[model samples]
Target: MHYSLPLALALGLLLVACQSAPSDTSTSAEAMADATPGAAYQLVWSDEFDGEHLDTTKWNYNVGGHGWGNNELQFYTDARPENARLAGGTLRITAIHEPWEGKEFTSARLTTKGKADWTYGRFEIRAKLPSGVGTWPAIWLLYTDKEYGNQGWPDNGEIDIMEEVGYDPDVIHSTIHDKAFNHSIGTQVGDTLRIPTARSAFHVYRTDWTPDSIISYIDDQRYFAFGNTGEGWEEWPFDHDHHLLLNVAVGGNWGGQQGVDTTAFPTAMEVDYVRVYQQK
Candidate 1:
């Protein structure tokens, strides 16, 4: 019953899995390369969108189109610069088709909730995606405030370090939504990777979050993970502060379930940088 936190993040993007199979994504990429974070990680925050604009002290545009709950059709803008920008150094976002307040399409959702939040880290994002179909790009994380329950999405968690679906082009996704393993009761914890030039180039979409687990990667290889089940926060809510988000959605309910291709309108989702490391 109770939905609404963008309809429980648009029904936690339904992947429909009863679950229980993971563990051999090359042995979870060799136990996440023996617990990543070499040299004990340190970066702590970055944006490398190399000055040209969009550094509003590290992002926060999340405007709206009302379908963010995933009926999505794009209209999220904040004084639109062709729907978010910053040229050569990267951070594109684009998803234009025209129209505006009435929503035909327009994009850009950038966020860092209150400008950089963390609690166990490693999140990275060197991007390059935005293909034909309805496009849905993402690089997520949440719980930057609502603590838990009722509106904090799937009850205080979500991580999806990267998701893609321009009609499943490169097939990369990595999920984790809580309230007892989400995807609306399908017991969702997730993983997937296909690569094959993941939409033309650039890779490195990662996440490592510690304090038990939450692996995921693309360039570093580890397909995905979701450990901490000390049986609380409804299957572990990655304890505290979380942030990041970037967008490109256009069609919804899983990127328009095989529709919308208006010549892939303006399409984009560049982002060449967005580091954040910890454990130092």
Candidate 2:
């Protein structure tokens, strides 16, 4: 996505509006197949976070302070429970304000880069997001192929199934990045919605990807779609395997636009479960 650049940030700019009570808007892992046109969807891989610790077999930690091309403030550390933990049947990625290892804030970025990368499939994550300004929580996918070298992003492709900033607590964002359509060039394919329960209740953030199109959804409600342009790989590089990334960033570009709420430290993005289904 080259999210490092602020091509167009709708959630970062919008203030919360139309307040309402939180309600359930979840879509089951098995429900997409009936409406999905393809081989019947089948369960493949998942992590329910039911254990006391993160399962190393399915995930890896991206530990660093290099800004990740996004100028993010958090120092992503490895195996630190305060930054990432699994308990009570959920995986919690907590972002807090504190001085540790020479960084002002600490958080965790979990990825399935080598462990479970996939091509076309339906991916779902049930999560309750963090609140307050400056928090940028995202559930996104990055291309995993090594053929293009360092300049592969945007060309390789990126799928942002869900992203919510702290200040705009009511909106959720979904977008797809490619060479033909990207934020840097102002041609990115994306959409956003305001959901009152976004930060307060658990909802399913999803992507239904096939050979023909890529669709994003929340609580079973479809909101964004990017159809295969039939042009070439420059516009549709999603035919290759991509890995998942989950993290909450602080004060950088879009997330830090309106200023950070110092009092919101230790806020968390709690993920109830993550599941993937592939067309069989």
Candidate 3:
């Protein structure tokens, strides 16, 4: 997901070489059905990223500076084909360890930002995670504003729909952070589901957000849920509308535990499609 300088140059050259290479372009509305084999759902907004380039209207990258919460090492960019691309009907967000504006890693952080913001709905992403050490791939949601009460972080709340570290290939985590709990202090409460085939194959990571509770599902199996207790910000700040974020981070405090794997330089999180469904 994230990389170093020499690796970045190598990946850039590799991408350039791959640009003219042939890819499988056949795509149908039935890709998900075929992958899941008997899942039932209606698609509202869906993008397979089927063209030769990124879809500017649907996604925008979050460029510049270290992220507020995590001391991540990549700068998100906007409209840069290097950060994102549509190849073989899949959206590839590659992370490389190259210097950019003083940061060592440059990767893509794409979001629905201005295009989509949902209060409560079913969000699903069919993706194949990046492999090797130091990669941190996440599918999460954030509030549209930065108002977080007296306290910053957890006061505003954060819903980690799904987060997976490269070191732990079989386990996926889902959590909710608020003033009362977060990952830093180890007070964060959530569940982990083990999917041994996660990195090797494409799987649907879904979250059903409703007024009463939030449910996380991997494939068709629901694994975790958090409810709004009507207590205070400690219980829920998710009542407001939030947008989606999909990124592959590298060499962060949590991600770089075992250090980087140079061989996996140009690692990528391939998104087959992203679909949002509302109650009919």
Candidate 4:
């Protein structure tokens, strides 16, 4: 059959083979990638959070008690089900009041750094945010460079698809940090979206990143945009591959601007799914 896109042809061939051979995750996920509504982008990687456990093949837990560069109160733990777990089709990253490793709170930080890195794609995540004074939940992306943290942040590029500070309910943030423009110098570019039901309901947070521009949205409605300046990586470090990061920090600089409620512990960021699509 004649197809308008090259991906359509590649997918058609993969599906036909799937029906004959024993089905595996690689092909099955591919077949379902473009099934979602959008501009016909092909799914390169995804996690539906459909298991009794957090899918290790797609994620790694960033565990530590150090401040995480944010002076966050929570000590990020690894594999502690109460901190991070998948159940009933959702991945919950919880922050509890109990102390751990010198920190008064415990939480989880998950990443797909080495396992799933995409050059440029339409990255999306459906989640229910946690809200309470001092809570900070974020879904973001970072460059896959070896000099990322060592050389300093922003220089490596950071894309915040969605971030919410607990005290300000319903006000969502989308930001991009680079050497030329960043929060440290007060020149970062970002915006807020007020969605009344954000804390109690699920929403799709998306970012369409390409070679030239990065546009973000909340349930398909655009709110923030950053385009290439063609000057250098200092201003547009997004011209390379990046990985995903999902975490809920507690009492950090931004989240603690109003101080920790203390009663706000035991909150969490519930992720229903994460999908990445690219135009092949």
Number of the predicted model whose TM-score against the real structure is largest:
2
The residue pairs that clash in candidate 3, if any, are 3-97, 4-97, 5-97, 63-76
Q: Which residue pairs in model 1 clash with each other?
A: none
Give lDDT per model, in order: 0.77, 0.79, 0.70, 0.77
- For model 1, give the 10-residue run with minimal summed lDDT: 1-10
Measured against the true structure, the TM-scores of the candidates, in listed sequence, are 0.33, 0.88, 0.80, 0.84
Order by TM-score, highest first: 2, 4, 3, 1
Off by over 4 Å in 2: 4-39, 147-151
Q: lDDT per residue, candidate 1, 153-254, as tens digits?
A: 888887888887777688877777778776566556576778989778999998888867778878887877666755567677778988888888877887
lDDT of 4 by residue, 39-62 (tens): 568888899999698889899999
Instruction: Write the residue-wise lDDT of candidate 2 on 77-174 in tens digits.
Output: 89999999987999999998998788789999999999999998889999999987989999999999844424587788899999877777878888
Q: What TM-score quantifies how close candidate 2 is to the native fold?
A: 0.88
Candidate 3 on 151-188: residue-level lDDT in tens?
45667667787788776665787766666555444345
Q: What is the lDDT of residue 114 in candidate 2?
A: 98
lDDT of 4 at 173: 80
Better of 2 and 3 by TM-score: 2
Candidates by lDDT, descending order: 2, 4, 1, 3
User: Candidate 4, overall lDDT?
Assistant: 0.77
Clashing residue pairs, candidate 2?
A: 25-219
